[model samples]
Target chain A: MSKLDQFESVFKAASKERFHYSPQELHSILVVTDLPEHEAKLYTDRIRDYLPLDGENITWATLTGEEFDDIGGLFEGIEKYRPDLICTYRNLKSQGWQWPYSLGEYLDVLTQATTTPVLVYPHPEKKEALEKLGQLKNVMAVTDHLAGDDRLVNFAISVTPKDGTLYLSHIEDKRTFDRYIEVIGKIPALDTDVAKTTITQQLLKEPRDYIQSCRDVLAQHESSPKIEEVVQMGTHLDEYKRLIEEHQINLLVLNTKDADQLAMHGLAYPLAVELKDIPMLML
Target chain B: MSWFTWFASSPTSVPASLAASQPHAHHAVSLGVTLFFLVLLILMILSLALEEKLHAKKSVIVGVFAVVSLLLADIFGLLPLSQAGRFFVENPLHEKIEMPVYIPAIDWGVVAIILGSSVFVDVTSRSGLFSWIAIKLTKASNGDPKKLLTYYGVMTVLFSAVLNNVTAMIIVGSLTVVSLEKLERREKLLGFLLIEGLLTNIGGLLTLISSVPNIIVGNAAKISFAKFFIVACPYVAVATALTIWMGAKLFKIEGLTNEKEMAAANEKVQSFDENDGIESNGFFWFATTMTGLFVGTLATASFLPYIKDLGMGYVALGFALIMLIRYKSEADKFYQAVDWDLLAFFAGLFVVIHVMEHAQVLALIGKGLSVIVKLGPTLGSGLVLISASAFSSVTDNIPLAAMLAKILGNMNTPSSSGLWWSVIFGANLGGNLTPIGSASTLVAVTIIHKHGLKLSFGEFVVKALPFALLQIALATVYVLLFLR
Candidate 1:
């Protein structure tokens, strides 16, 4: 079989694999915070109030940063709990506070630490935060068109506030997409236009399927959220911010690996500051 | 007297006459060479068996060892080399008799067939054809777990008959996990999967190209594909039934007792969209047709002398080339799909077997094993099956098959087909006895573990032991009744 054929088969086989369902009434969410114990409780309680958190649909546990040194240990500490989603509170450093790693470095370590999606709450909530935190009315999951965005989107869908709109958006990095097209076009068997189209389609395939998977997950839920799938062509930060403002998306979720990518474009730290009130779930 | 003692008394050298006039110097040299290769071969097998523990690639280890051994054997005159011109300078003497000659340690035919078939299967697997078929099979069963398990067993056999057992198990096992998960019988899926794993090995016995051991044995015995299929198919059917019955009893998978539960399971499984995997309808059909054609060729290749002479390996290569050309842009991907390490393993095994043959160790083993002939051919065949199966359960079957073929080929015992069948049955079934016995079993174990269904070796033995024993017993009876 050909490469295309192989990919299709794998995609099919993967689709057939059962998505393991935990036999628990409440989805366990692990909240990791660097704040003091009392402050951590407040953050956790605030999150509980903001989202549809109850003993029935969702339950949460809190862990302090000092309880575990590294991300790996932090995950291990909560392994028994089998937390579906990990919410980490990143308290942006004060002007005079001494820290070992920069916000980007710290976020990078935390995200790289686990495959689980991390719901990041930038601490010292802004005024809009309390209002937006109460309900995830409009949510958007940002994707890089890379593989495994499905997991991020799935989390976004699962946690979408009842009857709220969940947007699955991909900002197509044209540079990366073009690089692939250029490489594929060099193949003698493929015509230039055909190669370009094929490469573009291949790039869009995973992200689109991820959106579909997210939609599928949503459809199965008792309170199915409305979904909007968007594929925009431009730089990620600009397009993402635009989508966030336009959709009025309160919760933004993306891969942790993008911390570096977004940082390279001078958008990650600035975006966090700009959207200080928004809860960013870095998977 | 112990058989080992009595066996040693017999002349161990090839032809017996080689023992008569050898000088002490030459005798010492022969002993040294034999012992050296023997130790190396043992070390190689040890490494292969401990492949996971060693954290080394078996292909690299075996490939390097084979090449080094071949060179040493050739240098030491253990492997006799002849001038290429000798064949062209045909004897002007009337009626020249052709005798088998030592050429190379590696069988390019086996290498080609394995690589080509691997590539072909990889391509087909990529098309989601097998997974699609598996889903349809599940849907056809209508949410019945037992029936689904039964269909999975049959598909395992069919896929094993065409593709490698490892690939077959992965597809079947994956389908089982999905089906059972939907049925809310995830717990039972492990036992069902374990049985399906055994079936993959048995399915391999249904065709000459099913497993590596089958390929090695068939090539060694010069058994045509048709002949192999004809002999093994009936036994496969019998063995498959016995396995399913044993599995259902052991796994306690009585068909869904509750109609409502069954209906719920059916709804979930039916919800699966098989077309989600198919990238192109046109390519899927084309791939399906080509797969049918390949299997068709394998089944009929024996009757057509021209194709037979072209060799199974070449035929596989022919299919592989067509695939590469068809997917020219993705040629590199297909090429990358070939299991070079597996090819290396085969090369290593052939080289080691060649060394054994040169050292007359094979003849010695034949003499030792042939002692069972005195008890009768039926018993002798049974013994070979049981012992080979026992040994195969613990070691890689490829080398064991190679070694057994060499031993029994030289023995030229009565009911030759029975002996070959026993080796095939034993080797294939023995693989189900342990995680390391066969690639298929290992893959099954891995897949199950990945799904959070941890099955320890002891647990696997408990699940696999009964079916394995039943299959072997059934095989023994089949060989005695039919092949004899």
Candidate 2:
């Protein structure tokens, strides 16, 4: 409780962690699927058309289901190619996609085990994945705790086409918020009302402030996508689903890695599992 | 050298059961009948122990056994069927009169206390008091793993002393997960959780009403709430500190080496914003004050005029009623949240034990236990503690505590005797021996697994054995040096 320590705490509380934006260049893209090469070629062509990398000399590689036996073999293929971004659909090397309960073990491990950002295309069997081709104009970045997620924002911005709209959506889970608030209500010292308002504002404030910073920085770019922020407190899945439909978002960008857990982040897994018709960029 | 000599020489307080005037007179039954009832009791315990594997609810299993035992007892003419509405027909003076046969056996005082405490704690928790204190403790540690371990360990014990073990574990275990994750020290989560789980049992010993076993044994022994706290606090403090120290060493948790790292960690945790959990200022203060009053009232219930007569159970139920007034419209929610399965299990177990008593099953066990007590005070107490601890590690401790309390009561052992303390300590501390041993430890393992960490049953037992053994050893020495 020294003066310096007190000052450090005050400073840390006041200063929010801002998003650091850097343009991510896609030098090579790997398209992976469980279809045959001929069928995979058809899907890869559709992916190439859908992606915003129109004029770049990007090395494109396709690995059909037969190319790898398991998650290990898939990782080996990925290590050999060393793609800047891996373009794939959910339920790779598994029949889980049909059930919509998971993203299959391959994608689950792929998202967390590697540092490479994954551009998750909708399953090839889905008509929406085919129809959504050549439509990467409306990109949206979603997060449960949206503050300090610079990499996620950067990836979303990089993939968005010029003159397209980039929606930065932050949904503070109301259930979780209320749960903590309920615990606070039992505490004698805390002014529950002040806590309710101040904490809610603070929780939402960090992300809102970071999103504003994004707007300010992106405003300077000559051909940057127009930014729109959708920040509120609500159930994540329900809110995100509503926002996606309301905005007709073409691609959803989110972070998949949880620093403390081995599994994919709690919010990310359900979103990845349920939103099968939407292409999502998992970082 | 005989148990009778030891019992006669010992200075003991009059237990409530003994004061109530031996409700049912002990009668000799045929050996075959005694063995059958004993096997029935053993079967109930075994079924309860394998509850998870059997995929049968505890309440259902015990309820089935209770019905079977009652039917057999009725057939054998052990129960006075004509006096079904009376607990004790000997109460011609109307001291303990007019209760249904099953009602008297259930020990409604214990049930009331559990229900009341459960409702009160559940409602109080809705105010976010526990989480606020937890986050504050986290911030206080400045994100140092070693400091965090110590603070969380002590908090686990204190919380368990007031809250039930499962609730205590959930609150502290969750915060541990969040705090460790924030500090980027998730690698230490398993150790923190394991230590917290172990400390809960130690904390349970701190108060008469901290856990079910404590309530059962404490009530049976007629130990005052104040006395229970006084007797158990020293052991709890020492054992909690040792467990935390042992965990720190085993897990290799250490503090920041440099001031820079300390400052950074402090800054990181300071951003936690403890007040973020609070939702209602009015309710928070109300809950805080009520929690204080609840503990204060329970501790001094013996001194209070009306409450003294009614006992701690009435005080608990009364406080729960007061808390429920706030959510009077949604009272059903709190009621629904009550652990009905546990209450049902208690009811059924009481019936089974009551029937066993009718068949002289307790008298049979009492004969065997008398031999152990004849081994001299220190060695006898140590053996009982060891045996209870071992039995509790594998099966539900509630029935063990209840049965032992009855057996000891039947033998006319003193309330202040080391035997009573041994059973209390053994029943509470034995849970630390394995994940399945206690609800709190099981919860800790579940939390670890939920975070995608692998901590199998063998792994938990291996890691927790040292702490459990040391705790039981400390309890044995504590009983010998003080309680005896």
Q: For every model in order, what is the number of clashing pairs?
A: 6, 16
DockQ of 1: 0.08
- Per-residue lDDT tens digits for candidate 2, residues A191-282, read 89989998887777788878987987788777889889898999988988898889888899998888999988888889988888888899
Give candidate 1 misplaced runs (Cα > 4 Å).
A1-283, B1-40, B64-68, B71-76, B82-103, B182-184, B412-416
lDDT of 1 by residue, B1-484 (tens): 0001100111222222232122111322465676677787788778778888888887777777777776776677554323331211112232222222222446777788899899888777656687778778878888887888788889999999998887788777766776676677888968887888889998999889999888887877878888899999999998898888888887887788788887877766776667767778877887899999998898888676788767888789888777666678878977776777788778777776776677665655666787875568699889988998988887789888988876776655433467888889889989988888888888788778877988998988887887888888888999899886
- Indicate the residue-level lDDT of B18 in model 1: 30
Candidate 2 lDDT by residue in tens digits, B1-484: 0001111011232233342455344344798999999999999999989988999988999999998898898788676344332233223232333334565678888999999999999888877687678778888898899999999999999999998988888888877777777677899999999999999899989999999989988888889999999999999999988999999999999889899889878876776766545579898899999999999999999889888888888999999999999899999989988889899999999999888987889888989999999998988999999999999999888999999998987788888898999999999988889887887887788888878899988988999999999999999999999998
Model 1, TM vs. native: 0.64
Model 1, span A1-283: residue lDDT tens: 1332333344344443233222222378888776677887887888877666466656778886567666566657678677877776554223311332344444555566655666776564444556556566888877665245445555666667767887877777787777877887788886889767755775576567656655565566677678887875677767777887788887886655554453322334445445555788766
| Residue A170, candidate 2: C-alpha displacement in angstroms | 5.6
